[model samples]
Target: MPLRSALAAVLVAIIWGLNFVVIDVGLEGMPPTLFLALRFAVVIVPAIFFVPRPKSRFRDVVLIGSFMSLGQFGLLYTALAIGMPAGLASLVLQAQVVLTVVFAALALRETPTRSQVIGVAIGALGLIVVGSGRGAETPALAFFVTIAAASSWAIGNVIARRIGRSGMTSTPLAGLSLTVWSALVVPLPMLALAFALHGSDAVGFALTHLTVPQLLSTGYTAWLASLVGYGIWNTLLARHPASAVVPFTMLVPPIGMTTAWLVLGEIPTIVELGGGVMLLLGVAITTGVLGSGRRRRLRS
Candidate 1:
């Protein structure tokens, strides 16, 4: 990848990493549902008018929207709400890479190479180390939720790959997602359950107790991170080879950790630092950044 692509990767990582801190801020007085509502609103309005739509069908729009917006964010935010730490949430989500490879092998018939298996094993080891460091009694529960979130994300990735070909991919993806959460998904049953389970106190507190900073944080998460951040990243994806570009995602967790430290004053644990390095190294190897066969094949 060019230095420009590397820098773009870093920019996306920084914006995303700060999102965990932003979510913490936004959740102060904002219900996750309402916050998500406001988020997509920003994308659909003034901005959507400016960006052109892709050539894909409404069904395709719904497909990617469900995976990318609904599935990915729903599980992720719920996991965070359920006591998953922000930086750790960022780190644990690395399970998506593993899920993606496995899904591709099964569904798309992509054969796994030796390099991928080695990368995944190292990545799994990093996940184990991170889990051990988490002070939770039921580390297994946290891990299960984290992995579920990753699997949902992987599903979204596959959908997005299809949508990205259309010129209007990002806008529709963002628009459809916000619409799903706000209009379809956030019906009375959802709120009724939220109220029943957490009580009006928790839900009520989130709404009335929100601040200006919190609102902006939520806006950033929905608009900038989802809309602009993913928009640019997907545009890059449309131009670059998947093997060349996708590897940059491993950099996101580290970026998120640094952002959490700087913004939230949460220093990374020693384990997080090591795990982050291992994860990135694993990604690098998986992407063929360390390829010897390429050189040999070139010579041949």
Candidate 2:
């Protein structure tokens, strides 16, 4: 990957890392399902009117929106609300990296190199260590839901790779337009889901009683995380192999853990920290940054 695209991916990681803290704070005052509804509602508004749809097929856009927006965020918010800690949630969701690689290989024929496979295995082991330390604390339902959220995000990544390969324009502006327009397809289904889960009364109550922090969380997630983060992310995926782009997401947990500590005052356990280190090392290996020089030296 180019340095610039790498930087862009890092930027998205930072934004998303902090996003868990923001969601946790937001959920303090709002119902989870309702919070999701509001976030997507903010995502698609007057802005959707201005952002032209991407040249991708309507079905592609809908699938992307459903998985990325509705499935991922909806399940994630509920998991946090139900009892998953912000720091742990961040780490667990990195499971999507493994899932993405699998889906990309099966669906897109983007086979992983041996090094990539090794890295993913290391990362999965790290996740196991982290989960062993923290698993006793989180609710079973919340834990399973978070796993489901990760699966949803992985599916979305594959769909994004598919869209990129299908010849959609991927200029930065087009990327932003795609993000916003794809988001436009989410609100109705999300709202209906929110209603089905939480009921219309709960949704109305949450909306009427919106706190400032909740509103800010909705805004940040809509504009910064969804629009800016996903826009840059989709652009990178469009230009690179899914394996190359998806490994950048491994940075998210470290950032997420740190931000959760700083903002939410949730400290990590010693075991979790060790796991985090292993996770970062795995990401470096998976991206070929950690072992590239040695590999080239051996080749020479």
Candidate 3:
């Protein structure tokens, strides 16, 4: 990848890492599902009018929206609301990195390089370490729910890659358009879920009484994270192999954990911190940054 592309990916990681803390803090005194509905609603209006629809099949757009935005964020917000720490939630979500590689290979026949395979194995080990350390402090239900969110995200990544690789999204705006258009799939179902969980009256109360912090959080998530971050990300997915792009997400946990600690006071346990280090190492190996130089020397 070019340095600019690499930096862009890292920028997305930082934005996303900060997003967890924002969600955790902002969701206070609010309903998770309802907040999600409002976030997507913000993503849709006005901007959707200017952005043309992605040329990919409508079903592809729907599938991407369903898995990536709806399923992933729906479950993730719920997990955080129930008990998952923002820092650990960020750490655990990196499971999508490994899952994305596996799903890409299975669904897209985008074979993983040997380093990718090894890196995935190491990354999986890191997940196991993190999982083992989730004691009474982290709710078991929340941990598993976040894993489900990761699975949804992985499926979405594959779908986005398929659309990108299909040569359908040829315009500079296709990725952003795909993001905006697909987000249309989120609100109604989330509103329904919110109503189911909290009753219509409660949902109405939360929406009407939104706090400034919550509104700020929604703007950050919708515009910066969903729009700008994913706009760059989907574009990158179109240009590079999924394996090459996805591993950069491993960089997210450090930023996520650090910000969560500083902002939310969610310090990780020793074991969880160790697991995060292992995850970074795995990402290094998976991205070929760790071993490529030695391989080049041997080749010479």
RMSD (Å) per prediction: 4.3, 2.2, 1.6
Tell me how candidate 3 scores on lDDT.
0.89
| Per-model TM values vs. the true structure | 0.79, 0.91, 0.95
Alpha-carbon lDDT of model 2 = 0.82
User: Per-residue error at 160 for model 2, in Å?
Assistant: 0.8
Encode model 3's per-residue lDDT on 41-89: one tens digit a residue.
9999978999998889999999999999999999999999999999999
Worst 10 residues of 2 by lDDT: 168-177
Off by over 4 Å in 3: 296-300
Model 1 stretches astray by more than 4 angstroms: 1-6, 137-140, 164-209, 292-300
Best candidate, lDDT = 3
Candidate 2 lDDT over 1-300, as tens digits, reads 789888999999999999999899999967776778778788778778878878889999888888888899888998998898898788888888877876777888877889889988887787777666664567878877887999999999999888888876545476777787778666776678778977888888888888899888989998999888998988887788776888778778878888888887888778877886776667667667668768889999
Considering lDDT, which of the candidate structures 2 and 3 is the better prediction for this target? 3
> All candidates' lDDT scores?
0.64, 0.82, 0.89
Best of the candidates, TM-score:
3
Task: In model 1, state the lDDT of residue 164.
Answer: 54
